[model samples]
Target: MAASLIGRHFFIQSRNRRTLTLKSRLKYSSAVQAVSNEDVESLYPPVKPRFPPGNWTSMTEEEAWTRYEAMQEMTAVPTVKERLEKLTKKQMRAYRFPVNNKSVRVLEFQKNVTKSHLIKGLPTVYDSLQVDSLILEKIKPYIIEVLLLEKERLFRSRFRDIHRDSLILRNLIQTLLPLLYEHNTALRTSQVDEEVDIKGFWDRSGFKRVMWYDPEMERPKEFRIKYANDVRFQTAHVCDVSIRTENPLKEFLPIDDELCINEEFPVLEYHPKVFGTSKTDREKSQLTPGYNLGDPCEFGLVSFHNTVWLDYQRRKYGDAVTEEMRQGMGLTASFTWLLAQAYSQGFNSLLDVTYPMTTQTVLSDGQKMSFFAYQLNTIDMLKNNMANPRQNICWYTDETQLYEKIEDGKVIGFNDETCETLLKFLLMKPERRNINMKPTLPAESSDILSETEFISRNPLDLSTETN
Candidate 1:
């Protein structure tokens, strides 16, 4: 064993010496020297094979195929799970908009071609309607009647719960009003600064009719579908343009002229049971203070409980649901559509000039209230105008509950989240630069049946279809 070990050590030493001698000889040899290919190949070669194997001459076809197969397995793309993990990690590190309140959640954030976050909600009602908007002219009176009846019912009910903790009403003043105004930056910031004359509007009996379509002689055929079998094609619609007018006398009742505290809006002597006690006498005129361009001629509190909201929550979170907990689920469609139409067609007339066409709807039922505001911006929906049908709005909406803390008949802890949200809504003014509304032909132009023209053209026809 000792002899064998000595022999192995001597062999290693001899190999090292030979390697050193070979390296020195290769380094010092003349470039012109003709060394045999076999001898040259014996020098220290590559530590490992090349990545793509060899040139065509060095690698056989079978060997190349084998290498390709091995590489295919090793360098395969990531699986779905692996990719998702990587994406999740990257997203977690990215900055996100801080949402302090758990109750308020942003469900969607859509961007348009300009990459602006002016997301318009779905137009559900508009798509379903086949008849021309002129139908609104006929049903205007009926709609007013129904709404007034509903309002009277709500007021007569005089539920104590609604007045004290009215979520719907609170949402209107705080959320909706600001949202609508801010959407059109001009109105939101009072940039136009146009002095509006309300004397005429106040003098009138408060019954006014505004035409949605222009009075033209030529009519365009806009029949959606004239099939006899489909009754859905003949349906007309009533928009939310007709809202209730305000009567200070009915609203601020119990406090007559003698007992009225505020001369401007007539404040009640004592807080009414139905409308609740005002935190201060200042509240009468303090609702939506900055909207000076147009007066709220059609302002009225409404009570509408949304059952759809309750059902949705019940399914989503298995939470306690109530009928009063109404959600304005599908109303967004009408709100967006009407506002777009108004801005595109009522720019000068229906906006704030002739009469304050601005309308406000506040619905409260459950523990919350939602608000919607409509203001006309531009009325150039005709062929010769820059009428935009997309994202051209100056409206506001909110669902945050109003009072945060109440103690001893006074709100002690006001909700910071709610207040902040309202402030944020106010801060968002509509910018003309951001308005990407393109010129689209008016939907009403499809029919040239103005009230006057339709009547003159078919004087003998007294049927509902003719006129």
Candidate 2:
């Protein structure tokens, strides 16, 4: 019986060993499968390259095509030469001259008067007063007609359709004609004062003093004298006239009239000496010895002429005056000219014409020195005259183009074409730039502090301590 028990125990041990071997093999196979799977995953990674190099990745295909179309549209518009041709053709078709006329003599006389000024040396020989009178007489009807027609058209057109060129021309004519009339009238009434010391009066005032005998008075009893405080006064008379008032015995003459005699009032002048002096003081003060003799209105006109020349450069060569140009001219001179031009042109709003994301410096001084970059907004009056008027054009800031430049949380430079396109888009309407999303964080979420945090920090005992 003992032998039989031993045999059974041996059999049980053998079976147990076989089972252990099978279990060990299964464990080894499972581990090998896991490691093989891991190796396969490492060979083929999930991450991919965002985009190919040197191509715009942010814009979708549709968006890119849209931008390209806009660029083409801007370039496809008629050139200046084509526009000029069309305009000339239109004008020729619109107007017709009468073939038969008794008015030939009148036309001849008008032509002679207009041509007289163009003849060499004739302008210098003929009294400016006579020349101006003749010019005015010949053009008066034409001027009146143009003004009336323009006014009627302006009234008919919507405010947005108003053209800047027409507005500028109108302003120039309106400001100039009245002064010319006044000057001519003054010239007509003027008389040579044989007895009076004209030289002495002029020496005292630093200007030529002219005496005009009143037309109504007999024997030149009542006289009108006009003088200037400075030699530089050109269009502006600054007339300090000693008029024959009703009361002759009144010793000190009553201040006659403070008239801005220039056709263009507030004419820009370069007077380095007058820089520090107040306008009131400059008008009141007499020219003295050792004073700096600065450039007058003539100089201002010359400067304007130079600016016009520069404009021609821009139109013809596309060589516009940049920030570098401003630097070449002294800062003061550049800014002064800029302000004068802007004011003269009646630009109510100026675009800061700097690169995108650039900041401008504004002096704290009350002299209104503020540097801003913007695109010019232009209104077209001629288009307004047409059946369908184009909308007002304004400058817009391009956020999408700018966004592409933003790196490391800051914007760098902008593409010129893109900037120009955006500006043109803005010029079409009066609306502010549409962001389509909030630029700044909302008020509620901006600050980190919360009511729950404050309440949780309060001092309160939850359980009593054992004594």
Candidate 3:
């Protein structure tokens, strides 16, 4: 056994030595060598196995069809989910501009706005629509009958839990709209939507409407949709009553493309809504404008707004600031309604309107009403791209008094011009002016509407035709 063990040890050592000698010899022999082109060519025979050559001529019909299908598969549009994944961005916090955003109310940012400034902010032309005193007098007696009746209804309002101003405004609209129905047949066909959920976006580049945020107070926390991936004011101004019609009202004024093609516009330096801000709800953010250039929306003839948001504004900020806020409400509502309609029709901040859309706003506290006529000529005023020459037009007037006071149930000092103006707005018919509008609602593409539901919102009435 001892002899065997010693022999095995010697055998192991010899094997180790032999292995090392072979490894070293191999390492020494290994050297880099240049291969002749001839040797490399020999790796592949001239006649290789691919498709047996002359056996196949041109592609057959079946092969062509298969190839065409393959090409189509390769070039087809991405799936809806894939498109959404690529188009939608990470949820971002944004500024919301509610009709009565409390932050804006307290911040008093709108006090900086004026007629010319708003025109510049919107980059729109401005005009004043006023009746001559003599003309107002001539029609005063005829309109006074309805004015007195509206005043009576105004006094009869049961303010109850509702705010005084809101109630008065409601009563005034209820009493006055009927006169429109009696005067114009077109108005009778109009649809009235109350507290319509209005939402949209506008470039808040300060432009002519420059305003600074008060850093002393916490910044306002409101967010709206982004425009072409840019931060814009999400105008969610509420309309007390929106009168929708099949036809859009005629444009009050149209600027010639050549005349104002080189006109200068006001530039806003800062948008106050972005300052002292808070985090926003990313879930509500929607990408817009570029995709909605030609969609049709419900036409709004007249929108009524209430000064209820301006609570005690008269005393706290004084009449000047109060007036500013009032103008802001009317202006914001007017712009947002048109924008929302434009959005419905696929006209967004990224896409300007092909033709003008008109809407009238009545801002009131029951007694005094401020009227504004807005003609949205263009909406492509995004900060990065404002090359469009046409300016939007808004015709506005200071508060027109319906009456001075209600003395012992008798209306006193009723203004004839105010009544006349209000009636004219109500009488403003939706002339058969048609713009390219998508009959289907935006939400129809999703689960928001069914076939039956789509038809209801489908204003074009193509149901009878075969596809």
Candidate 4:
């Protein structure tokens, strides 16, 4: 019986060993399968390369047509008209002011009479006064028309539409601003091709040229630079649209009334010398003292933000004015006037220490227009150049209302101060003290101009040429 029991135990142990061998074989097989699966995944990855680097030939016409037809059936391509509609109407919400031929009023300035005509009652040999007036008058209508048209374009655009919205503003300055020079016989604009590259030209022009002084080197340094990606979008280059006016005023302001406009008033001459180029202070400057002349091309750069945030409010309250809008208009008007002065004086030298010039800025909020005047006393921009430079303009500005509002086309509640400011800027020349004498004259000319230099506080003080 003992022998039988031992034999049975040995049989059980043998069965157990067989079961263990079967389990080990199965485990080995599973491990091999797992490795094979991993290898398969590595060989055929899920991610497809977007641009496969191989010389693959084009598919056959049948395959191509099948794919094209499938795409056409799945989706439709939008029309150009639909795309343009989305861009203009839905994007900008642009509209225009009520303008027509009747909206235009011929602003007549009394034909400027010559001093000789008044004293001797005889026309000079060369009487261009009528021609100048006629030419100047023709440009006024053109200016008004352009301004009205641009306002329509500007007010309609979304500010973020940087390309479409800013295009007209840029065009206004680049294309239209030079039109003012059309009437002036003393000035002529270059016929710059629209397609020409002007980036290099603007970088060095007197107006756009912004520079600094490197104290370490003790020399004036130019910090203006262009990045590789800094490209203007379909905009005319500064050089392409820049108007370079040639003035012989380096020797004189024409004594002949026919050659000059409003000879009774002062004609501001651009100082021939370039200022703000010096590394040293004004007192230590070896160069003749003058204000750095600005380029005519950059003069008309008046920008206004198209505040998307205020659009809802503006729509709710039609023809309403906000503080932000007022501020923007003020800035735009100021820049406009500044450019006007720059363009006017382009033939004359730039402003200088010899004769300081004051210009009035008129800001309109479509409802009401305000006015502010700034006198450029100096352009020694390098005096305190750390990171930012100091503004060289002097403050002679007085807060005044230009018009209460515009009812139809007429100006309502026109402020006398507004009239005076307009007259001073439009009629009276900013720097007219040397109107009679040549700018290069060794002798001193008459000091008939009042001590105030520009517009007065009292509106009644209009007895001067500013009236």
Tell me the alpha-carbon RMSD of every candidate.
Answer: 29.2, 38.6, 17.7, 31.3
Q: lDDT, candidate 4, residue 94?
A: 11
lDDT of 1: 0.28
lDDT per residue, candidate 3, 1-467, as tens digits? 54456457768988999999988877766484555676454655575344332222233444335434533442242332222233234454456655554343422343222112243221132214443465446555544444455445555444432355454555555655564465568777766766656766554433332122332332223211112323445555556677777688777655564422334554434455443434357554443321122223258778777775565656676776676567667666777777767755644443446777778888876676788877777765532223344565556788777878865556679877667677667666667755444322333332212223434554775667668
Candidate 1 lDDT over 160-180, as tens digits, reads 442322333332333234434
Task: Report the error of model 1 at residue 335, Å.
Answer: 2.7
Off by more than 4 A, model 4:
1-169, 173-179, 186-372, 378-467
lDDT of 3 at 88: 35
Candidate 4: deviation at residue 369, Å?
5.8
Q: What digit string (tens of lDDT, one per residue) describes model 2 on residues 23-123?
A: 88898774655434544546666664443222333344543454455334433433322222222232111111111111212222211111111111111
Q: Candidate 4's residue-wise lDDT over 308-352, tens digit each?
A: 333444565443333333333333233223323332232111111
Rank candidates by lDDT, best first: 3, 4, 1, 2
Candidate achieving higher TM-score, 2 or 4: 4
Query: lDDT value for candidate 3?
Result: 0.54
Q: List clashing residue pairs in candidate 4.
A: 94-156, 207-295, 266-432, 270-348, 270-349, 270-350, 271-349, 271-350
Q: Which stretches of candidate 3 lie over 4 Å from their true place?
A: 1-90, 101-164, 202-229, 255-263, 271-279, 286-297, 383-386, 434-467
lDDT of each: 0.28, 0.24, 0.54, 0.29
